[model samples]
Target: MDTTQTGLPVRRGPRPRATTTNPHVQLDQNAPAELQDRLRDHALSLPGVRRGVSTVSVPGTVAFFLDTPTERPAVPDILGGEWGHIHPHTDGSLHLHVPSTLADDLIAAGWAEYHSLVSRGILPPIVIMLYGPRDEAELAVCSSIVEEAYLAAGGSRVDRAGRTLGLPTP
Candidate 1:
């Protein structure tokens, strides 16, 4: 294993594909442009949020940073992930960490469902997903739900400097 200066092992091998079962199925990318733009802008606008490489079952995937600027964000225990993220998929669905109540609410409302990874425990149970919205109204609601994930991760402008400086924030 290749170790970093911090002595943490770096992941270097055949990368795992975020998508497989649906590899043959293509999601509508031409649509949801507006929703994607909104998510990108909102996530980037955060004080310390930075876009990371893809880690999900879609194209144009990006992770939202939280808690530790140098390390990836972990889902708050309340959200059921020891460490997790806000993963937005190109298909307009999000593989993000969220609380059970929120997940249940969305699922009951038919707004979201669990990602396959969540089932195998490869991802936290909170990694709920919502398929691409069919209209602007649904898109708007989806955007807000993603924002809730960021908040649950303790992502906030006030905590930016603290995380970046290696000081406790949450």
Candidate 2:
């Protein structure tokens, strides 16, 4: 055993563990429906995307689940090549988790277009989650868009297979 000058044991092994949880995993309730519409349009415009679904929880939180006809897209350089695997659920839904910050950037850039769609009442509430930095500001902006859509749609929520969109039940 190694003893320090202060009579404390100095045993070295693996480093202390760090928590992997992210405290910033929150959404803003003020996102306009137009933003979500734009996100859906952008996703659909992608080469492989087949369909998109947006879910809005009360008090404002959006989650988007995009259904792509092909496998997950190759890692983009902007995301430091952080790869995401394609997860195929039993219900025929495919999930691809990418950097959240990247998702936010994409939404912010196309927000105006999305807002236009919302004005038409053709979009639904949904949050987009990707793989990257946890940018609270971006998420908040996106969330506001989703929140607006949900409210505009008469506050109606949808149920997908076993998943509920907008305000989970107690």
Candidate 3:
């Protein structure tokens, strides 16, 4: 006797391909043309740097993606006392958002640092994105970077899951 449910055969194998289009699969609508140009220019100013993907919008913030070879230095002086906020999205990607005011200084300092690093024969390329409110979002992103560096200097208190994971008080 054939074992079937609802008069359909049970086939065990790879799932079939999806034929319908997902309405959400569209270009990033947040990014604007002028903002794109600014992000590109700023990122290019860094030494030994290469361009990365960026998107900007009026309500959203600017973002950069640097393709560096080595890990970024832990400069406490540069970062005030707060590492940038880090979030693990549902897609498994980590998103770090630094404040705008600090973001500007960080990028400037980053360029100087990058040049110094290159002089020492180190190639550290970074991707940077700027995002913020329509009026002053760029500044906000830069500020955030600085804030993050500051936080790093102080030390991170949270865990990978965004939960508090620190030593017990003695």
Report every candidate's CA lDDT.
0.50, 0.28, 0.28
Which candidate's TM-score is highest? 1
lDDT per residue for candidate 2 within 38-106, as digits (tens), equals: 543433333322332222222222233323213333222221221111111111111122233333333
Off by over 4 Å in 2: 1-29, 52-96, 99-170
The model with the greatest lDDT is: 1
When superposed on Cα atoms, how far off is each prediction in RMSD?
A: 14.1, 20.4, 19.0
Q: What is the RMSD of candidate 1?
A: 14.1
TM-score of each prediction = 0.59, 0.24, 0.25
Model 1's alpha-carbon lDDT is 0.50
Query: On a 0 to 100 scale, what is the lDDT of residue 86 in model 1?
Result: 34
Segments of candidate 3 deviating more than 4 angstroms: 1-31, 52-72, 75-133, 136-170
Where does candidate 2 have its weakest 10-residue lDDT segment?
A: 85-94
Q: Which scores better on TM-score, 1 or 3? A: 1
For candidate 2, report its TM-score: 0.24
Give candidate 3's error at residue 7 in angstroms: 68
Instruction: Report the lDDT tens digits of candidate 3 across residue range 24-143.
Output: 111222224444444334333333333333232121322333333133434322222112221111111112333333334433432111212222443222212222112234323333
Pairs clashing within candidate 1: 74-83, 74-84, 75-84
Positional deviation of 50 in candidate 2, in angstroms?
0.8
